[model samples]
Target: MSIKITGTGSYIPNVITKNADFHQHEFYNIDGSTFPGDNESTIQKFKAITGIKERRYLDDNLNTSEMAIIAAQKAIEASGIDPETLDYIIVAHNYGDVKFNCHQSDTVPSMATRVKHHLRIKNPSCVGYDVLFGCPGWIEGLIQAQAFIRAGMAKKCLVIGAEALSRVVDKHDRDSMIFSDGAGAAVLESSEEKGGILAHESATYAYNEANYIYFGKSNNAEAPQDLRYIKMNGRKIYEFALVNVPKAMKSCLEKSGKSIKDLKKIFIHQANEKMDDAIIKRFYNLHGLDVPEYVTPMTIQELGNSSVATVPTLLDLVINGEIENQELKDGDVMIFASVGAGMNINAVVYQY
Candidate 1:
């Protein structure tokens, strides 16, 4: 049995904050720095950096788990599966659900239970677990879900990669401007064959280390700080992706007995258009493959990175037909890859 993402779902706050709105003078600093950003008129350089028009956000009021539950419920609905029947609940996070003292995130063990309760998942015996990683969380979760089902450890699972990036945004930081609160989830079940997460390969590089590449820390369980906001040596992280992603992709394909040529599409993590191009160029040189013309580069220009939820949101767009007329077919191979601050890269091969 293989694990297939039978159902896909996502949640972005209905609010549609635009890059133009960020241009308002209020967002400008007295020093002339503007977190709100520059108008499209002045910037002729990176004109079409990201085609994303807008992104969703959650008020400062909510936690990652709350957003996660919302997204998971949608997935559950789409699959028409009973929450109680879910055998495993895995949440990939860079932050906790709540303060350890009063919140569940600090002690991630409680995350699955809380999610079930939030979404009214049935029964009281489902096991809850958590996985921690940076932007690579989604792909990692997909691969793990397949393993669990294949092992018969789970019959049905709820996998989520929700991120509340807006809560941590530093209004004065241009880098943070791209961030927004968001959530994405999928209810996976045991598939006899055909669809879902078909193959996966991933590894970490302990030797190459840098700053701005670690998770937050919490002093105490009640009010955790350990898994706070994202950190990374942006420059180094990009370089790492350029080298590491290609390597990971090749290994994943080899282990699965497939190649890029066999894939109908490649769903790479949407970090930035520049990064996308860098990886695209790398792909051409190594495997002689170019990202299919119909591939979706969903990263938002002003919408900051949303970590784990990135790929799934793109997947949701595809299933919902938001991806538009494209060249993907029912049995095409699609690869999802991610390289994050941890100096870790994950690559998964899927039959979509």
Candidate 2:
């Protein structure tokens, strides 16, 4: 069984955050870690060091659910599927509505359950839930949706990767400046087609010590603290991506009986411009193509890092002409890869 992506859509808040924007914000360190900068431009070296330009974000009037709602609506229109016909709607959100309408904390179901009500999804019986994963959440949910579609459990599934990363950013930290808020959606439907998520594979590196790179779990003890803001150890994440991401991409390609040469395009994760640069430099020499030549590197400096939202958002950007020269077309093999804070990395192969 195969799943066809009938439609694709994405959203980034109107608020654009540049290096200057972050510098203007206050810096607070409850743990007493000295924040090392005065203004945004002073940290321009850090951006150059990290290789990011800018990232998009939502201002006061915005939040993750709102972005997700916008993207999902666009995806519904692109998919040509009425919202009411949806059988399952799964959101890959680190924290969509942290500043809830009433409550202090946000739960997966709390926001996901309302997609139908808010969008007036035609079928209220459709199951809508949130799948909690780090940066790799999009691919993971995609695989699950494929299973549901194959088993006849769902006629159509609307999967969204939305993250409100700024809510948790340690503003004073320079390494955290790249995080942002955005949303992306893809509609999966049963298909007899050959392409579209032909092979999906993943790997995890759970180093006992490095696990601290990106680690936050909901205590659910009494009040769920700020578990939604994505965090990371930038240096450690870079190491993990350099070592494991290439191997994971290979593992997925091998599963499909293909190699890097056969791929028309590899849509690697867009967390940073450097990761793709390192991958191409280490893996294969994409002749006549730059490392980021095929990649839609979403600049984290402005939008911040939207965690799981990065890859899919970039994908939609390509489709919508936001990305130059290259756009998504049929028979293109895209490799999805991500390195989250838990020192976790996952790679999957999807052919579109």
Candidate 3:
């Protein structure tokens, strides 16, 4: 038996927030000092580094769970699976549902429970839960589902990655531009067919890198210390990822017993353009090969970094042919990798 993603779906928010929209906002440094230069120059620099021109925001009337539900519905439809037959529902997220204009996160019910409730699956045996593994959460969830299947604990599982990062961002900080809102989901099941998930690697480096990406007070010094927003030391994260992510990917591929030449595509987390490019380059260098064109697909230019949602959302887009010049075929070997808070890193070697 093999574990495979039977279907995939994603929900891209409708509200478009362009870089030009931030021109009138006051930007500040971590110490509350005014940002150097004008908004135009700042935005240009941001674009040059991150390659983000715009991002999507969840509608004011909806929350992260709702987005997950929508994506889940599409995935279920695509899989032609009965909701009542699902053995597990795993939702990966960071901040729970943060309503528009609200500071508190609603996690009492748990995002997975919320999705199961909304999906209206009535089977009491359909276990549901949540994971908080930073941006790599979805890929981690996939690994978990595969483990469950391998252990004969489940037959079918629904995995989702959803986030409303826009609601948790400190608008006063320039880094805020990197975040947005979105959700993606997939149905994983045990099948007789071959070419499924072959191997995976996961690690957490919290000793000295624990605070690279964190929730901290706003950049504006006057902002309430009691209220915190998503924050990160970009330089630290870039350096850390460059050193570790490629190693993880190489290890995963090696464990799968697949050669570097077998890799058809890499669905990496859309954190930053330059950082991702460098990681891919380094990964190829380790294999004594040049990076192949179109090997790494990205959605960061239009979707920004939606916390845990990036990898799954990008996968859903490519699987559905929404991303141009990218396509997957039978017998194709691919790698899914990501790095984020927890200073966590993970990679999955999959075959389709």
Angstrom error at residue 181, model 2:
0.5
Error of 1 at 177 (Å): 1.8
Q: For candidate 1, write residues 58-78 as lDDT tens digits.
A: 665667788788889889889
Ranking by lDDT: 3, 2, 1
> What TM-score against the true fold does each predicted structure earn?
0.82, 0.85, 0.99
lDDT of 3 by residue, 101-126 (tens): 99999998999999999888899999
- For each of the candidates, the C-alpha root-mean-square deviation to the true structure, in angstroms, is 5.3, 4.4, 0.7
Residue pairs that clash (backbone atoms under 3 angstroms), model 3: none
The clash count of every prediction, one per candidate, is 22, 16, 0
Worst 10 residues of 1 by lDDT: 216-225
Write model 2 residue lDDT over 119-199, tens digit each, in one string.
887666688888776778877778788889888899799988888776765454455677778888889998778787767
Better of 2 and 3 by lDDT: 3
Candidate 3 yields a Cα-based lDDT of: 0.95
